[model samples]
Target: MISQSLTLTWRSLVPLKNSPGQLLAMLIQPVFMIVIFVYLFGGAAGGDRAEAVQYMLPGVLVQVALMATIGTGMNLATDIGNGVFDRFRTMPIARMAPLAGRILADLCTMTVTLAMAVLVGYLVGFRVTTSPLEALAGLGLVLLFTMALSWASAWIGVIAKSVTAMQGISTAVLLPLTFGSSAFIPATDLPGWLTAWMSVNPVSHLAAALRGFTVGGLDAADVWITLGWTAALLAVFVPLALRAYNRRVR
Candidate 1:
């Protein structure tokens, strides 16, 4: 199963060689977000430009990580819509290989996006005040969360009627989660009702955990909360995605 998944992962990635534009768009997305948020909205959001960069970069990383998962669903939906999954169904491979392969490919994409975000963040004056290990830990946490979310995305992709519907559903669900949380502004700065929601918001915890890891203050609580959320997402979504994949292929 592992070997089959790896091979299919390469298959998913091979198209990038012929689609330079797609790869270019992926590379450009993080850079664009960092510039737009750190330069244009930094002053208004964080008061000091340097402070804004530091505060916003971690949140931006979380945001970008979550947003990157949307593509997983869209790509899967595209494959299904185009009868690619039908071909997989007829192949003498593990039933889960196709889904696992797509997800592994997405992880590769998410890693690149995170690396790009971190590089762009450094170029824009966002410094990681913590040790190198902690910075890497922060990135790892984001990836872990992203992987869990990709399962949910894969389920959505499997069940969705079309690629357009998958895109729409993903955007609708994720936009509120990303923007409504502490990904942009501080949660305490929000209104009472919104603050209440942000208090329990998983994205808020994930962002806070990343900030804690990269910045000076490392809170065990934030890390724990983020892990709890990650585990919960995986528990709910993995079975759902696998079942959906089975049904779709059948």
Candidate 2:
């Protein structure tokens, strides 16, 4: 049954073989955002900024992973809309298989997007102060963060009444979280009110942890905070998403 479920996931990823354009579109937004931020924010404003790339790169990468969740949710919604979920429900597979499989299927695309984004940053003169091992760990952290969010998105798709509604609702939830946090700058750099919020924001912590890795500082406190938040998100969202999946199936 587990094998069958995993096969379903592999089958799902196979369709992308013919949909290069879709993958490209999925990746372009993050790359574009990186470009705009680096040029607009990294200019004279950041001239005195210590490790400008270190600061900006982490936030940019987080945005890439966070944005990828939208695509995952929307894809799942499409599957549900096209009657694929109904068909999968009828198949002999573990109940969680469909959701797990779908999440696994997206790993490749998400990894590619991350790699491309990092590569673009590197090309434009962003060097990691961290060693290769720490850099690898940083990559793992982002992957973990992305997966947790992806699971939440899957649940969103199952509960959303329609694919379009899923898109709208998820976008609504995401935009503020992305913009309101310290993805683009230090919390202290923002207004007093925004700074207060950012100090406690999980996204800010992740960005801080990432920045630490880039500088080889490996801020243990920030990393612990980020992991704690990711774990909490998984603990809550996993069951919720699973419940929704079961409901959709039944």
Candidate 3:
């Protein structure tokens, strides 16, 4: 049952046929952020182009993965809209397979996004002075957050009344989550109230964690803060998504 369900995921990747453009769309923002930050505002950031690139890279990478997950909900709505998931229910399959497969497929997309982002970062002079193992750890941290959000957003997809609602809801949430965090500039640059907000923003912690890792080692505080948010988000959303799926099947 599990094996066949896993096969469902691989088969779903078939969408990449006419969907190659989807992945390219995901790359656009990361690359744009890299270029604009390095070329336009690098001087104002009080650092070399490389330093500015490295700082902004994590923020954009997180944005890439987080943005990339919007499709999870939209696709779920599409499946419902097109009657594809309904067809799957008539077949013998693992109860959780559809959602699981969707998440796996999205994870693969995230991997591709991550690779493209890092490549752009490197091209713009972001270099790792860390050990190979630490670099892997840094990459792993980003991937971890990516997958966690993917899983959480899948729930949003499942429960959304329509594809449009999912987009509106997710976008509304993402704007503050990105801009309210430390993505563009240090929290110190934020106003007093906003700086206070940044101190507690989960995305701020994530950006800090990724930034610290890029520089060579993990920040213990960043690790704990990110892990806490990941746990809380997963705990809240995964079951909600499962319950939504049950309703969907009914």
Candidate No. with top TM-score: 1
lDDT (10s digit) by residue, model 2, range 1-250? 6787679778888888799898778668667877787766865226643456657877888888887887778888888888888997777778888888888778767888888888888876678887888877887888888788888898898888888898898889888777778877767666899888888878887877777777666679888888888898899988998898888868
Worst 10 residues of 1 by lDDT: 38-47
Q: Model 1 Cα displacement at 227 (Å)?
A: 1.0
Candidate 1 residue lDDT tens string, 122-236:
9889898999999999989999999999999999999999988998999999888988988778877878999999888899889988998898787899899889989999999
lDDT of 2: 0.80
Q: State candidate 3's TM-score.
A: 0.92
Flag the better candidate by lDDT, 1 or 2.
1
The Cα local distance difference test for each model comes to: 0.90, 0.80, 0.77
TM-score of every candidate: 0.97, 0.93, 0.92
Please give the ranking of all candidate structures by lDDT, highest first, separated by commas. Answer: 1, 2, 3
Tens digits of lDDT, candidate 3, 56-101: 7777777777777887778777787788888888888865788778
Q: In model 2, which regions exceed 4 Å deviation?
A: 48-51
Q: After superposition, how far is residue 99 of candidate 2 from its true place, in Å?
A: 0.2
Model 1 residue runs over 4 Å out of place are none
**What TM value does model 1 have?**
0.97
RMSD of each: 1.0, 1.9, 1.9
